[model samples]
Target: MERFWKPLLHFGYQQAMSCLFPVIIFVSLAITKVIDVPHLPDYDLLFIICLATQYVMYRSGMESKDELKVICLFHLIGIALEVYKVHHGSWSYPQDGWTKLFGVPLYSGFMYASVASYLCQAWRRLDVTLVGWPKPVWTVPLGAAIYLNFMTHHYVYDIRWVLTALLFIIFFRTVVTYKVLSVTRRMPLAVSFFLIGWFIWLAENIATYLGAWQYPNQREAWTAVSWGKLSSWFLLVIVSFIIVAQLKHVKERREEVPFRASRDSGQEAKRQA
Candidate 1:
């Protein structure tokens, strides 16, 4: 029974790979035209690629399902909050083309996946530390502070999503860094990716809407940014750092048995049958 279930789980994950992942990338980019993905939504394509990337990170070791759930929550919640702000008019899109009729932009989910894929790609090299930036005084505030000074004329309002994102950055820089980078950690890439991605949404909650970079058919918010804008940018940098770290941890653990145990066991069991 033990052998049956273990191998079954392994087979299940593999089967899932043939479909579970990659639903976002190919489908989204084609729909949004961020890049040239065909319109079919490439579930298998994305899933296989994600599987490969996930495996590379697995060298760091297997993670718990629970951990993946937490990561997903962080990503989904953070992103959903961002869409709320975008919908509320705290910021605006560059073009109507990229904007969706939904409360947030449709491409928002793609943005989430893009960040996740990037993290998985580098799952091997993405280590992080919360230590003060090399020039802590400057690095601490560069993301937001720079944006604020650069766009003083902008209308940077106080959005809860942006604020939370900012707070998460500070926490990540000084706290979450060690947890994600260390081998003992068990959260899946999804959870780590989501938290880190949520942080990204939190930071960009305003920038994307405020015209930090214009979307299709959207007008730039010349005087739209405020102090809060800076906070959002700051969070983005921190999230980026952590995602990379998780990716690294994944790469480092690949050689270990637990990471690939399921796959091997599955293959062996199939042969026995």
Candidate 2:
């Protein structure tokens, strides 16, 4: 319908911005051999995908006062985790060639930017109904992600880590949900971001598991066989759906409705009095 075109056009512009600069970067990288075009890891391509998604969220028009804290949290979480993992030899590359992105370690900026970008985008696009502030179990997914990051990589058989991961996710979800505290069409950006962000992460996990990119000393994702990988995927997809729904469609609250004439009427009455 005619009404639909407006948002679509907006989304189109957003989608374009999301991809444009990245494309230029990709071309430049390729031209100068900044990033070798390879099948493994797919870092450059993934980064672009995330960037596009971020723009999509930008176009979605969702605003949160807490957005800055959320973004900062991502930087803190991402850089810290990456540094720690690399420190512990949790995962490593076979060669030492990726050392050019912003003068940080090869995977450092790209990884953090990729992850944080997607999170912010998806958060902005999440269904308000699903992302309650200070909710009951929001952290479940975040913690799971961190936990999976650890165990899945090193084959560390720590049951405690698994439990801790689950608990962490629950706590994270709780905190995020608490921020909004109600599941409405007005969920916080963090929850939505997590939903979509995780799906993209699943892509990385699946690809790596399939040997599309090798993680040193890691086996195929057979552990997923034991612990219900498919279920996790399903949950993640469901969360993504909530986010997509929020991004594409959401209901307005009564107070949110601008009362142009009504406001004028109230103002006139106040002036007369």
Per-residue accuracy of model 1 over 91-196 as CA lDDT, tens digit each: 4444333234454444444345445444433332333333332333433454344334323324555343554555445444433332222332333322344454
Error of 2 at 241 (Å): 15
Model 2: runs farther than 4 Å from truth? Answer: 1-69, 97-109, 126-157, 160-198, 205-214, 217-273
Taking all chains together, each candidate's TM-score versus the true structure is 0.33, 0.39
List the lowest-lDDT window of 10 residues for candidate 1. 176-185
Cα-lDDT of candidate 2: 0.42
lDDT per residue (tens digit) for residues 122-220 in model 2: 345432233333332444344455445543555655354454355435435422321122322233444444454455556556544433233445643
Q: What lDDT score is found at residue 205 in candidate 1?
A: 38
Worst 10 residues of 2 by lDDT: 175-184
RMSD of 1: 15.6
